[model samples]
Target: MEAESRTFADAEVNRSLTPEDKIRFLRDMYRIRRFEQTALKAYNAGKMGGFLHLYTGQEAVAVATLSLLGPHDHIVTAYRDHGHALAVGMGMNECMAEFFGKATGCSKGKGGSMHLFAVEKRYWGGHGIVAGQTPLGLGIAYALKYKGIPGCCLCFLGDGAVNQGVYHESLNLASLFSLPVIYIIENNGYSMGTSLARSSAFRQLLAQRAEGYNICWDQASGENIYEVRAKTQAAMERAREESRPTVLEIATYRYYGHSVADANARKYRTPEEIEHYKTYHDPLLLWQKRLVDEGLLTGEQAEAIDLGARAEADAAMKFADESPFPTEADICADVYSEVDEPAGDAPRGTHFFN
Candidate 1:
């Protein structure tokens, strides 16, 4: 197919990726993979509370894309966001602590797995509600435009969120106001357990909808980290420099259930599909293959990277286990933004709370 060839040509492995860069990419992706593996262990052991959504299969999308952002940029995504948070530079100890509901968490142990927020990191974090982060990302883009900042907002959502009303509404307004934002749909085959085929009425590529609002559109194979990085770079340029809005649909897959609990992924899709993906379609494995084929890495070196990640995650687990949990009286404390008053007569938090 000519179209397929063209897409491949666009992603022809970047010559600029130094040996160090290649090593780093492998390291980061492996880190997330190991982190999730450890988190699953903790979840089963009852160390982590609330629902756990593992970004097990989607590590490449988060790491490759966030590597393109700068300090001024902003980003938000859906609930399956632990990988995204770390990709944006959130520390491993805090992330694991957050998973364990420790007070040292990025969300101060309150947000749990689905809601990890770190303003200092420029990561707005994962929202629990479907399609909820769309308008919020748009608002962040609006603020960047208003402040005359050189930043863009990358809003990551699932295939399911595209069908929601707020998705369309924000897309329309972003195009109208020329918000510097790129809306990325991580089309991981299913919306929870439901396949995209059942829910999506759009017969063609989801990016086709962009034409109606005068926005640019693109697609990348989310299964390939290099392709994701290349395509996202072009879209990021159009948004950050030209003040254009774009919609990018990436075809990725989730390895685990929708949340950790959706053990019936096999009911919707065959076990063969899962096995094939892990063998050939996995982003990490695929990249490892590429690196070896190109003589950028040895099989032994690749295994070492995996071992390092697992060891690092084990250390972070110790940190989380030692961290403190929030107290009963601390419930209403962190609701809104305010510095702790200097031993004033008035109560601690806000006008309403104080």
Candidate 2:
């Protein structure tokens, strides 16, 4: 028999969450929103370098999903990863500094915008290549299972990445080895400049293709944090308890272009369509409204939270500005394992230019 559908009511009625917890979620989401806004401002002013893939509208997905991670759980994602980085507890200063290519960045000014990493926090770096993180996520899961740790690796990819051959290979290996991995396809309708209908070959939900690999699959609206938590929790449990893999597709949207470089972002889609999502389907607004309706939050308090987030973002940008850049000798560092010191004269490579 077909399983029953999960209904996510307007309020989502999550009684397990304390009032404080709910408010914190709201704050976290706003922090991401504000951080993205600040990054965009900096990018426009030519203060930062590299391709910045902003996480403006999809805050709820990263915030909610990452909030569910346990001690053993790990996460990896694509270039649009600022929200996930923040959600996983990386400081705004370090993240913003990474964009500015400062020495204080999470990757120490070496990895720039698309390569935020916090291994200590169990968050693998965001890969710039499409579907590149999929196999790495599988490797993490395989290690977890091999080590007898009841953990799962949350691998996030965009809709565009679903077409990659390596992604399917990773899925096959995940199912074959029963790796505890949850592949989250953040289906934001348009992959780069192409719409989902124009690019993908799907009979129904994109996640339904999981059936071919004999893995459990599901899709849900990414607008609601509660809904995201509910569905992700189920997949987490399956991974922990059964050591099974799942393919979860979260229907999300990005307000900015594919990257900061995509000039045709607004041209591909009509302004009215973007306005509709912004006005009605904005995750932050929807969550705030729900909290207010439940008497858990006041309108003034929400406004204050938003202001606080903006201030925090501004402060982070300032920190990034004041921080120093990596030294010239630090170029060949982190390339080879034997190169112990970052300021070492040279590595074992004969092709070293310096």
- Global lDDT for candidate 2? 0.90
Query: Tens digit of lDDT per residue, candidate 2, span 1-354?
Result: 012222443223454678898899999999999998999999999989879998888999998899889999999999989999999999999999999999999999999889999999999988999999999999999999999998999999999999999999999999999999999999999889999999999999889999999999998789878778888988999999999999999998888899999989889999998899999889999899989987999999999999999999999999998999999988877776656553666645564556
User: Each model's C-alpha lDDT?
Assistant: 0.86, 0.90
* Clash pairs, model 1 backbone: none
Off by over 4 Å in 1: 1-13, 338-354
Q: Candidate 1 on 1-354: residue-level lDDT in tens?
A: 447534653564444568788778888899999998998998999998778888887888998888778778889998999999888878788899999999988888889989998898889988999999999999999999999998899999999898899999999999999999999988888998899889887858877787888889999887776678888888888888899988999988888889888878669988889888888779888778778987889999999999999998999899999989999767777654443443455455445534
Candidate 2 residue-wise lDDT at 81: 90
Clashes of each: 0, 0
- Give Cα distance to truth, residue 92, candidate 1, Å: 1.5
Error of 1 at 318 (Å): 1.5
